[model samples]
Target: MPETSLPVFIAPPLRLPVRTIGRRTFDFSRQVAVMAVVNRTPDSFFDQGRTFALDAAVQAAVDAAEAGADWVDIGGVPFAPGPELSAADELDRVLPVVQALAAVSDVVISVDTFRPEVAAAVIEAGAGVVNDTTGLHDPRLADVVADSGATLVVTHSLAAPRRPHPRPHYDDVAREVADLLARRVDVALAHGVREDQIIVDPGHDLNKTTVHTLELTRRLGEVTALGHPVLAAVSNKDFVGESLDRAKPDRLAGSLAAAVASVFLGARIVRMHDARAAVDAARMVEAILGWRRPVHAVHNVS
Candidate 1:
């Protein structure tokens, strides 16, 4: 009789899950969705107030949708350590943009905030996802998302929103991140958020050293194994900048490489700063992987 043995390698997901946001339903198994980043904060790390104005943010979102973005993640506050922003102030920044975009387009709108008040308000304003980068630090935010039936992006981070988590440490970066995300997902479920309405993010560069973020990226398959759609927000992240010794503006190639790697490893969604480029990269990756068909496949076919 042959002895039974444990598997040496884990297989990639045969198909990614599907999630509906706003008026659109994305089949991640057949598509790598592109989520454009539109920061409404003046201190945005990458844009630095480029879309801080309400008009600018609205226009950026519309352009991203036109450029093939499946979703627009509008953030009212920078994830980096910063002074606290009041809920009212955050509302003032993102609500109008959400309302504006909802009126004009069906592009899935997601708001990057962790405050319960802000989460509830935005969901009411037509936002479909609550991108909480704080790892459910305030569990009440989960309650808000649950009540609204909005998709909650459960992210991993060691500190409160806008607070510094200097010298963060992890035993196994990927495993730890997966564990954190899984726990947060459970917390969301316990608070009444459904399983299908949940997404997971490893939170690259959020309270993590470049080395930590790199290891997490290489081992991203573990996070995807959690059975929820994984979102990789690798656009212009410090990890890419530091790894290739490139400045923020020069990290485009590295960012696309990271995003592609994440998709290959089973990420169902990619959140990017460069919408058109990211959309192209994602489609190319999907075509190469046989998940998407070429626009013109007439080279050999008569």
Candidate 2:
């Protein structure tokens, strides 16, 4: 096999600190954080609303926390082939879940919504993180985050000229994504969001073909150069399905592999469906590379 070109930017040892869940700060030197996905929607791409009821969703969140997730991301809207919910509708669906999770678990709760109103509602409900998949299109979103004092994640999705279903048209995928994230970071900054409160996501599978997704994963280090923590959300995405020659539900193994690769490449945060598996893989890889702490000698107590 031909050798791949070296990535332009690899994630440096420097890890910028950020707050999550109301004043709880995280530093990357701690280890990779696994953000478990909790889709409350009945039409989500994977598992498709397996937890439709409030009780079920709450249990799911709790399970994720018990399973070693650093955070539980709750989303009410589905991203698959379905009609988009209006801002009010989205808020109505998501707020309850966020509130429920916050009520039960201290695990950081991230609300995934592009609507600023929805974001505000969830933040008010005690969500610790705001994950904007539209790359901060809603101007009020940054304000909501600032008011809530929560960390924000900005992700990339190409416009009409270069969307995934229609084949993304990018001059250079990695640099273009990096530039887009930089612009979104500027937007967040303009709205009074602190530099340390920001994280950047490359929006894997958002508007990219299989090749584009792979290229993004391979060159993730370049995108991390934007100078904020990088979050990788490639779990059970269609691109993984294509890469593995399987359906979305059957792509868990491939997703886990990609998640590990993302961490190896420089992703500080990995948004995933199977949190425990991903965490185990990351820990094992870290051990192999001697990234984990050395155990100290202990006296025998027999």
Candidate 3:
């Protein structure tokens, strides 16, 4: 062996969280899960109403499941501070998809919403998890999840839903994100939510600059160290786009790299727009970590 100058990187031990959704329990440390995004909003940055129609949203969720996604995340509105959409309008866009998909698929149905009413309705419409990107701003959202016995994803965002977080600041972005997530997890517990039912996300690009998101991604282990399964929604995000100087449609490679990086740093669940590719990528990581075995070891065995 020749003298080496390359740095050796060792992955840290992951403290994964286990939770049961839709009567199925998932161990994050042992298995990587992909939550496919199906945004039923016309202003969605990625697809821009491609799946906004009721039938299209339903078909998209089904397609994601067939593509090996562990579940689907349905959203009615964009998180950006756009025009205010009433609860009824949000439900009209989301409920039909949830009802249609839940009636047919066992893949977990996760609804992305911060409003308590929307959360309640979706949970009733067969949603097993509420992907609240608001970091429990309402707290009533936690109540709805708790009351419905549904899983809750507490994502870190400084601003209220549909409100602009202008010129965001953080002394230490990673530390602050972790601290805020810890605080929000505590709030969920206080609101009668079960520990196993909670998940944390750093909310990349939601209210963060590209630099801040980069730091957070590099230091995601801190968030994972909180002992709740950390979810990274890095699919086609502006950070990935800006980091690689690629536009949204061209960010697949960056998105996979970021998603895999998050996995290396201890993220258990990856929310992605490209479900099939993400599922394949996640499984590859799982096999590399020895968390999952290869489907067939025929390369040498044969």
Candidate 4:
């Protein structure tokens, strides 16, 4: 096998102080976090609304938490190019799930949205994090997060909500992504969001081609160098499918590989559809890298 070229620029050691999200606090530096995806939308790229019903969505969140996911990201709208969803409709879709999960689960709750109204509603409903995939397209989203004392995940996406960016071009995909995330972090900070309450995602496949996403993964340390916890949402994305020449249902291996690679490159959190597999992969990686202690070391320890 050919040797891969990883980033040579050494970032400072990951030093993510504990961040409070609602009643939960996470110290991201010690181990990788697996964030399970729970989409309540009928048109989500993967799962295709299997969890769209309120009962199913709530059950999915509970299952993810029980499967060892540290976080559950519930989304009302799909990020793909599609008809826009009104804030009211989005709220109607996600609020019940968030409320249910928050009431019963100690697992951190994140609402994936870009609208300030939706963010505010979910935060009020006990969501600990507001995941803005629009890259802060609406600045007021940050305001809502700040006011509610919720964590904010600012992703780097150039397109407007539910809009497509055709033929996207970037001089340096990783650098540009890092820069955009930095700017978004600044925006969040200026909006009164605490620095520790921020997480950054490079938005793999969000306005990026397969090659772009691969390059971003290759150099994800640049984004992690920004001093905030990096969230890699590499689960069953189109880029992984395109890279491995596999369909969405068949991309589990590719997604897990990409997710592990992201963690190796310094991503502190991984968002994934298969929570159990992802949690195992993350724990294995952390253990191999000496960041996590083995749950029980036995046979070879003699």
Candidate 5:
């Protein structure tokens, strides 16, 4: 028997034209959005609870919106392996902040939680998106997003709640992640979540090693090929730290590089801790790729 070799797949242009999160509608084909990360948890990896206080969280959201962030992703619990947080505690942590931000700003609000109850509560509290970093471990979460008519960001991770897969092995990291996200998208669609409301994330560092995350970034178009707007949350992650041999605070440069690379590779939304920097980088990439026009065109034109 002779073996046949297939050609490598080249992705078509992303078909996600319009994404309506909360009351804001984005033309994904033309605009790349910077989603500011607002962690209301005391143990989040980046800010380390800087915005854990209600006032601080609200102010951070407002500040990010003012700084050009298109969306603000608020999280009540850290995704790192940690002690279990009660659902009520999680609700208390994020609901007030979501309520306050919804009242003050029109930035698309997203709550990073995998709990259906938390997703429902936050949507009722004015959140327009539910970002499940757990890869939709609970199918009920999809139901909640569907019922609320909120957008859903499904990430691919091979871990349960508060559990760690320290060493993960995948034959093809990007391909496997894309396949997983495709399945998740199918589940969401079957559960009544509209196709246009779904966004996919490859879950960088969630259950991957540094090399795996790098490979995923390099081949991000494979994930975007699924016809959904891809979201990359590579802000100050451990993979960036390990790749650059730098500490958490020093990985901003690496994070920015990865974010820009992801956007160039067709990621529509970038989740970042530094909203202003990320917004600048994303806009620069968009402009270079002709997706966006320069603000001022008077440099050297005759």
Candidate 6:
């Protein structure tokens, strides 16, 4: 009997179209876009007050672009334990950087804040995407997105009480987060945000322990299965640092590993700090796994 050659299984390269804060469309199928972090606050965990000066801020954005970041995410306040900056204050802190970046480069300028006023102001200044750490809480936020025609990254987080309170709870973290995200999508839809303009991040370090973060990473396929592109933000996060026994600055390698793993598990966009390293690693993974659609023909790769 003659032995027949078994057919090799090659998954098609996953291509996602993200309409960015730049008001232009990018093809993620071509490469994993790197999002450089630019914190304008005095208390951001890693680079707090690192760019208080406008020159420093502009330089940071320029450096991110030079370092191979496909986009630059500028935030006014620290996400850690601190007082949230007011909308006007936030606008003042970040709009200059956004305007500067928009003037110099065509790179995507993402404003990381939940305040609708701030989001509107920054987008008006030429920022493209609204990365809301608060998962669609302010109903008015949806209106801002619709009005500005900017893409939205709606990440998951537990609802906080009005009064100062203790940490929230999640009995089944994955299911609860997924449910909350599903509701968030419904909320956005109700408020007039288009489906294609939405991105869902499972809120990697926020309101989650190391075990929870690990579980979410393993189940990212489940999150992406919800029918929206996934943005995995595993850059220098507490869980990654704590898991690897490394300091914040030393967490780049760990973050890169986590980003690679998350993308392999079904993340479409990776929000990261080390843009060049992350983008190169993701491209290599895509190459090694043969995860790309043939440009000339769809059936050619298979």
- Computed on alpha carbons, the lDDT of every model, listed in order, comes to 0.89, 0.79, 0.89, 0.88, 0.89, 0.78
Could you give candidate 4's per-residue lDDT for residues 209-252 as a string of tens digits? 99999999998888888888889999999998988889889998
Q: TM-score for model 3? A: 0.94
lDDT, model 1: 0.89
TM-score of each: 0.94, 0.88, 0.94, 0.94, 0.94, 0.87
Write the number of the candidate with greater TM-score, choosing between 4 and 6: 4
Answer with 3 or 6, whichever has the higher lDDT: 3
Off by over 4 Å in 6: 1-23, 161-168, 291-302
RMSD of each: 4.5, 5.2, 3.8, 4.0, 5.8, 5.7
Comparing 2 with 4 on TM-score, the higher-scoring candidate is 4
Candidate 1 residues lying further than 4 Å off, grouped into runs, are 1-16, 300-302
Each model's number of backbone clashes?
0, 0, 0, 0, 0, 5
Q: How much is 300 displaced in model 2, in angstroms?
A: 15
Clashing pairs in 2: none
How would you encode candidate 1's per-residue C-alpha lDDT over 1-302 as one tens digit per residue? 23333222222453336767778998776578999999999899999999998899999999999999999999998889988889999999999999999999989999999899999989999999999999899999999988888899999999877888889999899998999898888999999988888889999999899999999988988898888888999999999999999998999999999998888777878999999999999999767666667898889787
lDDT of 2 at 267: 85
Q: 1-302, model 3: which lDDT tens digit per residue?
A: 23333222224344435677874678775688999999999999899889998999999999999998998999998999899999999999999999999888899999999899999988988999999888998999988888889999999999988999999999999999999899999999999998878888999898999999999999998888788888899999999989899988999999999999998887888999999999999999877767777898889775
| Runs off by more than 4 Å, candidate 3 | 1-16
lDDT, candidate 3, equals 0.89
Model 4, position 222, has a per-residue lDDT of 84
**Residue-level lDDT tens digits of model 2 in 84-132:** 5677877766788888777877888898877788887787888888988
Candidate 6 has a TM-score of 0.87
